[model samples]
Target: MAMAITCMLRHAVTTSCYENPANGSTSYFKTLTPVYYPPNGDCSDFYVPISIDYEQPEFNPKFKWTDSFGLQSFMAALTARASAPVPEQAPFVNAKQFKGDYEIAASFCTPRKPNGNEKKVIVATHGIGPGRTHWNSPFKPEEFNFVQYALSKGYSVFFYDRLGCGASSKADGFELSLETAKAVLKTLVKSVKEGKYTGKIKAEKVALLSFSFGSFTTHKAISEEPDLADAIILTGFSNNITGINGNGLLRSFVPRIANIENSARFGDRDDGYLAWPSVFDLIMNYFKAPAFAPSTALFTQSAIETFTLSELLTFAAPANISAEKWDKPALHLTGELDYIVCDGQCKGIIETPAKEMYPNAKPLQVSIQPAASHHLNFATNATGAYGVITDFLDAN
Candidate 1:
């Protein structure tokens, strides 16, 4: 079951179980008896070398934010250029292939005891927020942890930081395009399915899960390599280009050059990386009042990470494509009040993407979790969303 993978895992991160999904209360759902995660000796941390010769756009990362007006102008131009095809008339006008080994940090975990669903695993990639921790949150694990929920349901979880975030190797931000993101994810899927870590996930049935920005990368990877995963669940995202308020949400970031804004955390990065300058601005982009706890917001700020300029310049372009080549199961789940994706009303808007993006999902499903925002895991009603995710897995 060997594949195009090269990496070694580090010491197990969990010798003991920290949280149980059954601890939380929800009238609609119930979890199984808790099991010690990692099962005595299991691999947790990893650094995989992803080598790809991907074509990336050319851009001059020389703009300086002189004032708010300057920021608005830059955003407007960025959005405009992102929509244009490669060989864009002016900005990002040319393309060239950049290939190398990028060391990506990953965490793999499974239940100590096996069940009917044991070999089934979910490989998740996070959005622009935190890193892999977005799915395995630390502030309140019972209420916020997706890995715990999946584990209780007898499924393993493979989570990783994207190429240029967290403990992963940092490179020229412009080199980290959507294509690169797709390549990294595809390789990870093969690694998990082929049992790169342990026999636990080797040849296992895999599900690809993505949040917000990571959703597009998942969408692209599956389209290019149709059978990489058995099921696809895109949370905190949709292909509704018209309804998604990306510009407004991005402007709310008050995006600052990552190194300039928070030198302490992002100083290692260059001007090609960007981050939100304020905590509240990020809140407005992701959360809805009373739907989330204050501590959740604070935890999110503490975990915030930087994104790249190339990523921003290429995000909008993929919103227009559907997974036409895929004939497997697919689901698009999101929060009803996702301020960033739906502009605060996702009721009627969520259904359009089901037809447009995943028309070939053997039996495509869409779940609009009530009273939540883009950051579904951080919501007070998070487990409810997690239930819908697992239920889809259970059925498909």
Candidate 2:
């Protein structure tokens, strides 16, 4: 018998009902409903066939198993060398076409009642592993939905999975790289501008919002296009990666094929996919003493998705962002306790690194969530993060 896998994006309603804590009755609230666009309509999810060619680093098989104790020790010695600032490398000149056209899956949501500016839209992208689901919490949709918050503030949101993860097309994970990711994002932004997705909405003023690995892709894409987005908001990200307890976090991911007992949760995921061990959820996602209920972390672990090797490599690569060319409004928000980006404290008199990276941006802001972690949107203080984002968007 085939294993049963839950599709997180199956809901199609524009509103969700939440039980009011004060009363026993339930209250209906507007939520981000699933909507289909051109090409693949209600019959299937939306997908775009994009052909792109870019030079990418050849994959080294040895890097995959380098997380062992001995290797970790060896890598530790080279940490300083690895962290040494290096000038960004230029895009590969010997670019080759990716094996086949990439089919990207996207989800779109609009405010229940448009406040009249349909052209103003925000394009959100998720990090590695999960798809757009990372932007909102499924278990407590009413309380922890970023997309719904943005919609409630009157901005339509367009979010999708990168080529190799989530419901998007699958291929040799090695084939998905930063160059390809940038190409995919460029296409999506252009499509939105052209009103290709839905004839009903045309984007005139656009903002780019991204998390973790998605932020890296967005940085490269916006750098290349320059004017693709009018404003940018980067979450679960920082210019520094050396501070992260990488080796510890890396050990938590075992090859998906090795987790057969939990096959149903992973579904038919292919090789090159990394599965998160439930036992390490606390160390990996939550703080020692979490602010939210323990149930929230459990739900997050159960809903965790698989990540691709290529996506990992893309993020592991040295930062080669051309921020000097970014002349729009930009915001960088991360968690105070973001173990992955910050060594646990993202606050204080820390400089706005992006200001130096994106010197030309009209105005740049940097902020840290008080008691949050790498997964800012899912953290207990997620509302604070949302406030920072929406406030930045409104000001810009």
Candidate 3:
């Protein structure tokens, strides 16, 4: 399976979706309800694919070009600086071996003055791309600063780069597979569950904070390995289509005449960079004759580059693991103006789904930070509405 995972990308078309066993919702698969085609693909003889079935001009802001230039430019600067030289320090503990070709690297910071026992431990993971260690830019350091903040509060912090990312080694090309990714997470949880390293650090319970695609991957981890984390937070949730799953069919098969009207009214921004994830959604929306426009390609690319297409499929698929199965308390947060992830999509998947199944379970608190972009909202000690998130996490 491990070897197969590394090669899955070689043949993976564009995007893939999962079939919901419990519900008939083939969330990933379906034809445009406004129109239909025959099974043999012969209905195309008379059917024209150019009619715009629905229109939402306002959605343009959410999916427009240049909308996220400010944020992305800042990130780029940070990454460039972080690439500079830095002193190396020994890891607090040894890296743990996981499933085939995977390893979990952890860095620990014990409380300066232990009152009685070790302070609480929070395990964190960075979103896609790069390694566990962030670049030396202000924003990247901001992440380190947050971890340091936890330390100040007498909390030990453990973070690692996901496979094919920071610090961790990967095979050539490093194809992304949910099962392979989950295996590494499961291994980390198992080590914690069995108290392998509990003796060194008195970690009472592990708290996990994941953002963007990290949330999706983390959710899968918690679902498959119950003992992985005691508390979980998923930030920036959404449902978007991918390029591999029939999204490309529209661009390739649609009639040139019909595409004329729609292309002029709604289409991708050729001048800018459209991340892989957003490209998939745009293609899907364009095919369905719906407005799949995003504010900018950079924002979508941020998401697409954050996690591999295979990982996105896991997030979009019907969660086989239900809230009822999640024993630990979970908290949800989304940025109000987070066009890439979108607040509505986050609530739909995390908050709404949890409410339906676990009637008696603790309510999943959802917080929306006004005017906050995806990264800024999760920041610690942030001024204005962002402070509210810090306060909530602290109070909890």
Candidate 4:
């Protein structure tokens, strides 16, 4: 109670309202403020400090593929990696109560012209490769930025860096699991609802827009809290609970130490923070060509962000598979060629599982954006995919 009250009383970040897209009436700013928590914001005491403890892989970053006798052999430890990992096959840690004055580096924005959707807010969670900028890309904003697109369409956005990334508070990477990530997200949702950290936007409707691991975090959140979202859109997602695609994702990511791969940008981060070794790794895992532009793929060399190994180790095969009480609308958008989740084809593989997971969600729709990969926003036809998402949000 004390922590929540303290955080509540703390002054919100000060910054100018968003005005760049001059015609629209919204505003913008970046700030780090305290993020308090509950295990489940609706069910638990919202004021309690939340601590999440879960099993984690003992997979040390220092150990090479060779150290495990080979990459193939190391795969055995995580052989059962899926939506709900087979316990024996997992490589991990083990234990939750909640405690923390965590902080998030967040950017809040609203639409300019008053429209039916201006009060609607999308809480976006980016995948491993980008930060909050994934939604508001500085690189060719018009063609690829979802944030600018949403604002232009008369909606609001609350985007932020996940803990241990960008300007957000950094923690021991090994201790940062998806459970903790989900709790952080839930806390942020509560604050966003109260207009606490987000420049007091006081959103009328809140939707969850998630990609890749962020999608996993969203799934975890809704599994227990049905009321967490009004609408949910998951891109770069699939119900890969079983050993899907021969474990192609982990092999491609090849988890390299961030500092070793790009010392300049990641040298300050700890060893647990990981980055893929090369553009090839990203291309293999996140991009599909000739569907995507070469320049865009090349641009990823700069856009790439480091993520934690613990997140990967803990994300798959969630214990709870259903969001029975969530009767809202859902859009499961993925690239037809999303190699990571769909294993290069989305139609048959991704649809049914997503449907099964959100069985109670009314008007649940699964869309496979043609010619794109896991990085849907970076695709050549990204705007097309973005349209599908925004349209769903508007209608639902």
Per-candidate local distance difference test: 0.72, 0.61, 0.39, 0.68
Model 1, residue 187: distance off in Å is: 1.6
lDDT per residue, candidate 3, 1-396, as tens digits?
332243232422121212221232222111111011111111111111111111111211222223345324422332333345543221112222323444444444445555433435556655543233321111222322444344444555555556544234332221344555555555554555454444456577677766655666677676656557777766654323321232222222221211122222112212122122233342332211111123221222222222333343334342335556665566666655444454222333434554553333343566665444454323232233324433544555
TM-score between candidate 3 and the true structure: 0.51
> TM-score for every candidate vs. truth?
0.83, 0.77, 0.51, 0.78
Better of 2 and 4 by lDDT: 4
Residues 1-396, candidate 4, lDDT per residue (tens digit)?
343344334421111111221122211211232222111111111122334344434445443343214433555556545654544443443343434565667767666564777668888998777777677654555677787788778787787888777667677765676877887888888877876644535688899999988988898788788788888898887775652454566667787667556665666667667777667777888888887777666555455667876677666656236766778998889898888776777777776777777888888989989889889998999999999998998777
Q: Could you tell me how far off, in angstroms, the CA of residue 252 lies in candidate 1 after the best superposition?
A: 1.5
Give the top-scoring candidate (TM-score): 1
Sorted by TM-score (best first), the order is 1, 4, 2, 3
* lDDT by residue for model 1 (86-169), tens: 333234646777787878878787776657777888899998867877876545567788887787788878888888887787
Better of 3 and 4 by TM-score: 4
Single out the weakest 10-residue window by summed lDDT for candidate 1: 25-34
What lDDT does model 3 reach? Answer: 0.39
How many collisions between residues are there in candidate 3?
15
- Residue-level lDDT tens digits of model 2 in 71-161: 3433344233445564332222344555467777776666657776446788888876556666654556555678777776777778777
